[model samples]
Target: MLRQAQHERVHEGFAVEAVDLVKEFGETRAVDGVSLAVPSGSIFGLLGPNGAGKTTTLRILLGIIDPSSGTRRVLGHERPLEAAREVGYLPEERGLYPSMHARDAIAFVGALRGLPLREGRRRADELLEEHGLGEWARRPIRNLSKGMAQTVQLLGTIIHGPRLIVLDEPFSGLDAINQARLEELIRRQAREGATIIFSTHVIAHAERLCERIAIIAQGRVAFEGSVDEARGRLRPIVRLRTRSQDGSWRSAIPAAARLHNGEWVFELPEGGPEPLLKALIDGEAGIETLAIERPGLHDAFVAIAGDAAAEAMGHQEPSE
Candidate 1:
């Protein structure tokens, strides 16, 4: 239990806080000293490759499983389940009774979260209709396609109007269309003042949806901060296409610059590009194309967590 003053300090503007959290299996440590602060009404992402302890950390935060060590507070409660009615959780492994109708399934989940059955059913119907699944409301869960069934489960997750929502790999198995829909839904929920924390191996989803993120790798936090800050780990890259193959203008290019498919690619210089641009012009380099590109989230992840982690994120390396 946290002291009143300490708890108040930690929860001032945060919906969830975990400190030095560690979860250990018999012979393995699944989560190693994970710490996170999720601000109220923010979309926070736990990003990592598979088996990186993201799920374990989330489960610990929600009090679904006791951590081997460390403390966590969710919605002002040290015991997260005490705030169950105000929190919604969508686990990685989705399940619904096959015999249950879609609406009933959603309402049942809401009821478990303390919503009245009648109101839950009403909200379930409204949600299904709004999400273009009204016709399937009465259909059995098993009767719906996988994507539709997943949608129903997602609707059920928020039927109780939770103040804090945790979704583990919410975009897994979703098609491009459904993935976009889920992203919009998440944004809407955050706009309405719900604090959301979702875990995903797909860095692209995190890059697109989250304002802040934590990158977990090998059961440890590799990095944690705002998305822009993550990208700032690497300098912007300068890619140039010039008419001349080799000339005095080449001296102006960074020594580390490499030729790749007819383009000179290198990190932007600390002094900026103006000097280099002037040098190139004076030397008649005939610059055809010049692009200074900021590092993307994928690049940042690779830099922070290594190539293996990037590969686990489902992105292929550029072929030579």
Candidate 2:
């Protein structure tokens, strides 16, 4: 499969491709007709609420489970496991031998993927030092903090120098500092020519790290494309707060405007903000604050996936 990929002449430049993939457990369909194409050397995100089948889709892509129907390719290999040596995966469920030393655990995982024990140990040492865990390298997993253990496990995932890295909910249990560090690491890896695919229910991470994203909801893909394109689905918003409730100035407000926390928030209508501002000023509306709000990924997600899915994911209402 590797050879075929090398000589196939047709280059879609895709690091991973899942076409109409489906997974079923009894009568329940976990992932239904999910299709994705992740570009090479890019950071991609699979975003959705809990039980949205993101894990199922990833498992199928990793060859951990077979799809009920459809096909997929990893690193251009039609058979995903055929490219196993070139891929690194960190599952949502994390585990490390409590008694094992941090460095040794990394080495062991590397060794399983055909990296020599000595070389693995050497790389583990460098990775630990680079990630600010130099003093904890030889510490037992049981003694390490949760953040440290997760870092070690991540180092293990990449110790073999895989070109493709897949992380499932990598930021779930991390503190803000650790999450920022992980985001930096992910960007660095992509800059070094590694394709990264991470799944998360938290939209913030995807907004910060991903160049391309897929929003999965209710066992299906709700949206897929560049972050800018997703946000483009909605128009710019205008939020205004006034010092007084003047009924005469109400005409300046668009019909779509909603009252929230003493503010009038609404999408800018056909004409821009200038006309509205002019009308408000002419009407002597005591404007306390007026600002144009760019629609964010969260707004796009709500628009694409619907309110129910957003609510299930605990996404705060836009006014918040």
Candidate 3:
């Protein structure tokens, strides 16, 4: 609900809107009629498995590659190239030169993005120091671990404080502490009025980090919405793990999909969770450990994505 509301607010406010976007490399269609609305100053996640057209979409959005067909509006402008300078992109599968120092590597990246050499190094030193990597200032990138390299890459992306931040798998190789730090950074950036597009395969992290997510699978969006709405799509499954009355309590399993182990698990039909809870109590089974285990975004993702992949192989169109 918040994501949709944010989407509506952004549609009225921001200039970055992707409409029916399509991309192809040779004969293979990587992105198929994908449409997404990313509002400025919000954290939008583009999530999917490998080869789901996520990186390709970001590349197209960045003007690194042109879309086969479709349109994107950034800051009320149609030129993605001009709009690109307004963006900061941290790619997923890229590497720094092995011999370069961490700070130098980052400074070089910033320079390529139009930042002056002196200013780029200045910002790089501040960011590295801020992240407790002051000691790693002169350390070679080859000597740094994967997590440290990831931090350096992240710093490079934001040294210029671009209006929009596009991060591909920003959480990869990051420990819990760094992940939390990255989350904080994202929130801070959003508060500063910068739109952020974060791409990752880690669903739970995305669930916690993003206000809106466009889940792509097999070159298409499987589900696109807020976490709450994604969970709302699933039926409420009540797990009653109480002291079973001689296991005979399963006889009152609503005359449907019976009990799972000691807990009665069944999909909530109509109405909502209240009806299901009331029914469990009315079935003469005392609910000592009553909990409505709402299916997470993972369930929604698997269900939606699996269906989408099946449909794609079947030569069918995207399903709801």
Candidate 4:
């Protein structure tokens, strides 16, 4: 038991790592030179547009398919199949037997992942009850609502207590309330020492849940860093609201200040905040509220990838 538990810890500690990953599907290059790592107890986010190689990259990591080039390790095992028992994966394309009850569907997946049928059934019951689906456990999956079915699918994925969970577009059918519930569930899993890597196009989920994220565009890695680190790269623009009578502030305002909606929108002088604040105190602008208009990860994504995201989906925007 000790050896097995220790091995599980080791596998969870360095749950996933990849280097120079590339994959080609005949005529098209699906993934190109991507590298990333998901450390234990952290929620790592994979972000990209529809054809940006996110699915191919995840397929390689999960061992569903091998990369054309590069290397990856999961659960401390070089072989994906060998590590399968310790990893739970929720694929973007969901599959559940429509005629099968929710409990049976979950137990089936659990058994396939190496859990004893009895233990798996016990867990399925517990989870169904916990997720407020106890009343529907015996109902066929085809009878459940789409969101409820998705919730059940996720619960099944983790029923066996896998050390690392990889979720692909997990919020697809979930409503806002259930989405928040899933995010909290992810946080709880991280607190319990499980590493999670989830793919999503939603920036808010990535911002709220991920400690670190890797942005992929055009089948390649555009950026990889912590959420705060990503925010630090952009020029911090602060909008200061002030009035003419405020002689107490003058020198500290940026030279590019413009009055809009009763607020002065200007880039926080690259010189730094201390000097900016010092100057504000001496400026004639009656400073009301000092608000930093930060370019969040979403903004960075747009800046780095241009309109490829929207364009890929066949949408056009008005000229700037």
TM-score of each: 0.93, 0.89, 0.84, 0.89
Q: Residues 53-84, candidate 2: write the lDDT tens digits.
A: 99999999999999999999998788899889
lDDT per residue, candidate 3, 218-286, as tens digits? Answer: 678778888778777887776666654644445445568666676666775566666655655666556
Candidate 1 local Cα displacement, residue 116, angstroms: 0.6
Give lDDT for model 4.
0.80
lDDT of 3 at 34: 87
Q: When superposed on Cα atoms, how far off is each prediction in RMSD?
A: 5.0, 4.4, 6.5, 4.0
lDDT of model 4 at residue 37?
A: 83
Error of 2 at 150 (Å): 0.8
Any residue pairs clashing in model 2, and if so which? Answer: none
Q: C-alpha displacement of 162 in model 3, angstroms?
A: 0.8
- Of 1 and 4, which scores higher on TM-score? 1
For model 4, state the Cα shift of residue 257 in Å. Answer: 4.4
lDDT of 2 at 185: 87
Q: Any idea how many clashes model 1 has? A: 0
Model 4, TM vs. native: 0.89
